[model samples]
Target: MSGVWVWVEQHDGQAASVSWEAVGLARTLADGLGEPVTALVFGMNAAALAQEAIQRGADNALVCEDETLAAFRLEPYASLLSGLAQERQPDVILAGATTRGSDIMGAAAVDLKAGLIAGAVGAELSDGRIVATVPVYSGKLMSKVTIPEGSPQMLTIRNRAFAALEPDAGRSGEVETVAPVLPEDEIMSKVVGFEAAEGEISLTDAAIIVSGGRGVGGPEGFEPLQELCDVLGAALGASRAAVDAGWISYEHQVGQTGKTVSPDLYIACGISGAVQHQAGMRTSKVIVAINKDPEAPIFKLAHYGVVDDLFKVVPALTQAFRERLGK
Candidate 1:
């Protein structure tokens, strides 16, 4: 009756990477709390995903399968998950702060009357209760929070905030199927279509990222950055300045108001390193900055820095990487 639960979000019959990452964190929490880690998977073909959950660190899995649950419709999915929470009475629940995860968790919180924390960067047990460290004021400060007594603690973590558990084929666990109890009238929304972005890697999932800023000069300035990204097999990112100037699409922007990324390596070209911009990518493993201004704040955060014109430095760096990579 008392356990840590993770919501496994899946897409195209495959589990999302963030869901695996959450399971890894849940494994740690469950161990600390001396409880089992349970994964809740919901979709049309969720049994396979449930197997993946066990391999990725879950002690057991609960799968809910139905045609209406295939594509994420808020009402039915929330109703099923919230109903399960009421019946199973899990102690803590964790989910990724993705579009689908956020929507479903928010609705479930309302249905179960649970205390919810959004965008938690870290979580651990403190004196027999779950405490989470959450970002506030655009990542300027972190606040530790605990759910009130008599409530199931729920948390939504940002993508890439934690490392994923490596899947092991040798691992095994139990899987239980839960029938969906949805009335036709309760399912109000339907997903008619889904279109994926063209020729772009997800920023949060990319190991390497090449980002441009205002000093890139114009839209054409991104050409060199793109070349470097291509050579490194990296995603392309932009600062809010470049995005606001119409030099790049908003989808490519990395900032407080934009997407957050935690790549293994991040190369910032001509970016001044505003607090808002840094908030999104500061978690990256290694930061490299190239700019003419030696006084730029980005240098403070960069592990490696070059004080030179980005126009010249970027192309030189690109050509050097191309040769080194045998591209």
Candidate 2:
């Protein structure tokens, strides 16, 4: 059956959490479009990872296992996927918006001339057509785009945009072995040794994020923010100003140049929402902004707002939450 084809992402030979989340979203889109879900896994030994995809609601798992595919490089991975997509010709193609993933989507779209959508918040099927919602204007506005006269609509979903589903071992799905049509001689880029970035929490996958901005004053002001995040079990993110001020690292910066986070809860502390910062976090499920200025742009989009000093407010809120939870 022609269906929604999703790429199951794995990093460093292990299945990544974002892949599971993508499966959940694929299930939703497939159901809405009245199509089965077919997943693609490519690696040195992605067979084991393919089995995990079945439990995550895939109707069939396509495996392309080869030793040459051990590491992720541009040429081989892209050629293999582009060939599979051409022959399979599914109605919709969905991939995660990660380092390797984005690269694949851009290349595949070029090869197939298919419509590509990035950072999709949600997708819907209406009048026998697929329409998707993506953030625009640095997350200041949301646009629902429709891909017209396309063979297969390609969409790259951001991480943490949807909740993961429970795995049911009782339910088993089909698995198919695929051979790469493209030969190794045609591949251009070669794989080299890899290094993993060090971090306490990956901002993209954080459920709750506590973000600070220029209003925090300086590096010393982050102490309260950090304490509050620890109390709430949340990740700490920062705006460009805070990072530029040497209050935090660029990795913690939330903006166009940094990571995009759509956490369940995003608490903006002492921040005056700049367009750049909003670009990263406007997709959050619920936004709570705390700043001394009531007119801050963040308050306009925030579901809850507190116009007060973050130093005083953060500690009080933390205490209240701990007390309420009987911690």
Candidate 3:
């Protein structure tokens, strides 16, 4: 049990992509520490996910299955993880920097008195200690931190910051079912229903993103952007200004206040990049900017840029991609 552990987040009986990514990183860390990688899964019928975890590089899967654990409630989940950590004394725990992951991990860390690193993009073992690199100052700086000696290190990594390992169906590992230690009354919160979002790929999982800004004019302006996104199989993103202007939901916003995305390609249309917006997407592998203003700040960070009206440029680009991709 004194090894690396990943908290696998699942929804609708499927594991989150970030869970697999964390497994990949945990495998690397476990290899360096000469320890086994264990994945902790919680949900009803979570046995399948435990086996999936093994195929994704985990040596062991610790599953907690119960009707009460079907939906994610903070207290029960956090208490369960804390109890396990106290009993098993894991060397390191990794979780995705998602809303639920951040909440549960912080509570568990407080209970275990462990060092927690949030929004970590990279990690390594140095001098028998786990060191994590986290972004600071709107992604302008990276601060490296190490947990105190003899304490379990807890880290929440950003989505898309690490790649997931390919699953090998032939791989096998141990799966152990564990019961929750929390009392019935201790589980205070209850989930009554679920609501699904409209059709759109999550920005974190998207390989390509098409984003718009104030220059998009209004909510209607997103139409052309959506068309372009559809053609390229990309997600639609919005600058903070656009979101604040009520042109789009905050979920699609990308900035310091929004989600961080490191897609393979990012297309900024009519956006005069602010530092906050760039901080969220500056890590993208490739960036293309289209703006009528040649002095737009976004152009400085773009690998390719075109100074023109987006209304004309975007449609043309969409048509061209559609013709070439035949989609």
Best by lDDT: 3
Per-model CA lDDT versus the true structure: 0.90, 0.83, 0.91
lDDT string for model 1 (119-221, tens) is: 8888888876878888787776789988958556899988778878998899899999998878666787778898989988889789999999999999999
Q: Give per-model TM-scores.
A: 0.95, 0.88, 0.97
Per-prediction tally of clashes: 0, 0, 0
Q: Which segments of model 2 are wrong by more than 4 Å? A: 181-187, 190-193, 319-327
Q: If candidate 2 were superposed on the true structure by all CA atoms, what would the RMSD be?
A: 2.6
Give the poorly placed runs of model 1, Cα more than 4 Å off.
none
Q: Model 2 reaches what TM-score against the true structure?
A: 0.88
Best TM-score among the predictions, by candidate number: 3
Clashing pairs in 2: none
**Arrange candidates by lDDT, highest first: which order?**
3, 1, 2
Residue 153's lDDT within candidate 2 is: 83
- Clash count for candidate 2 is 0
Model 2's lDDT to the true fold? 0.83
